[model samples]
Target: MNTWRQTSPTGRALLVTVLLTGLTTFMFLPLLAVHLSSEGVPAGRVGFLVGLLAFCSQGFSLLCGLVVDRFGTRAVLASGFGLRIAGYALLGAGTASATAVAGIAAIGIGGSLLGLAVKTRLVAEDGVPARDMLALRSTFVNIGVIAGPALGALVYPLGFGWILAACILSHLLLAIRLTLRPA
Candidate 1:
């Protein structure tokens, strides 16, 4: 129905942002385990690092909520994206165990704030039902879920540095565009 052309540019960007975020996230975040194991990191530490990512994404929501309330979605989204860009870079590039831990924490915290900011943007700005928006978002995520891993698999031999560079560049471009234009 030509809906793609009909939707506002900002709406399309929002959807596309989610899609890329999905792809970026799946591309290497999951590979932390493989990377750690190969590096001789103990299994227990690997589990803790992985688990820490999940815990921060959820555990820090209250703080994120407060941040959003104080700063507004645009600011929060920008900040979250900034954190994610740095976190992804650190996670992928850093060799030290301590650096990895810091990266994981950044990813988790950034993820929490990003999630909250996006949902809040959906509910507050789009007249569409949150359910519908969520469903659409999931569709993008599903595409990412399939493609992200495949892309990662293709790039694995080259190393995580390449993957992280792609991620950082993409996020940086998106952030600059979004911050300048807004939605």
Candidate 2:
């Protein structure tokens, strides 16, 4: 039962990370629907594809703690950013290929790593009480969750690629912030 608030710099980063993760999924949901719709993937398969992505992303989270321990947060975080970028691109291009599914998996995998990495970084930085950090972390994550669906609904009508592009920018912003901040 750890607790933290998005009032400090590290806390702000945590919020950003949660938002990135939430946005990543939110950005993909409708896009996936649209992408599949255009590809004639069959309406029935649409649910299956989205389910597959969620399943894979959730699975990745299960192993992220171990991965973060072995690789260090910096590497894991950077890779997470890179994966998101690549995942979105692959997904967007997946309009004509199977790579979109792979892209979703990649995003899921990166998200798991990012989730764990942020937690580890926060603890390492003494961001909050160990007893309440998890709750706080989840709170921010849920905020993203709440926002993502709305964002998807808003963007889904326009185009899925734009949502993916926005996600890329989010990652880039995190990367740049990480680079400029003293390690």
TM-scores across all candidates?
0.89, 0.83
How does residue 82 of candidate 2 score in lDDT? 81
Taken over the whole model, the C-alpha lDDT of each candidate is: 0.79, 0.73
**Model 1: number of backbone collisions:** 0
Q: TM-score of model 1 relative to the true fold?
A: 0.89
Count clashes in each candidate, considering only residues at least 3 apart in sequence or on different chains: 0, 7
Please give, for residues 1-183, the per-residue lDDT of candidate 2 as tens digits: 224333467566766677676766765665677678787878767776777778877888888888888988888888887887788778777644478677877777877777788878766655456546666667777877778888877876777777888888788788777645765
- Candidate 2, residue 32: lDDT: 72
Q: Assess the local accuracy of residue 81 in candidate 2 as a C-alpha lDDT between 0 and 100.
A: 76
In candidate 2, residue 48 scores what lDDT?
68
By summed lDDT, which 10 consecutive residues of candidate 1 come out lowest?
1-10
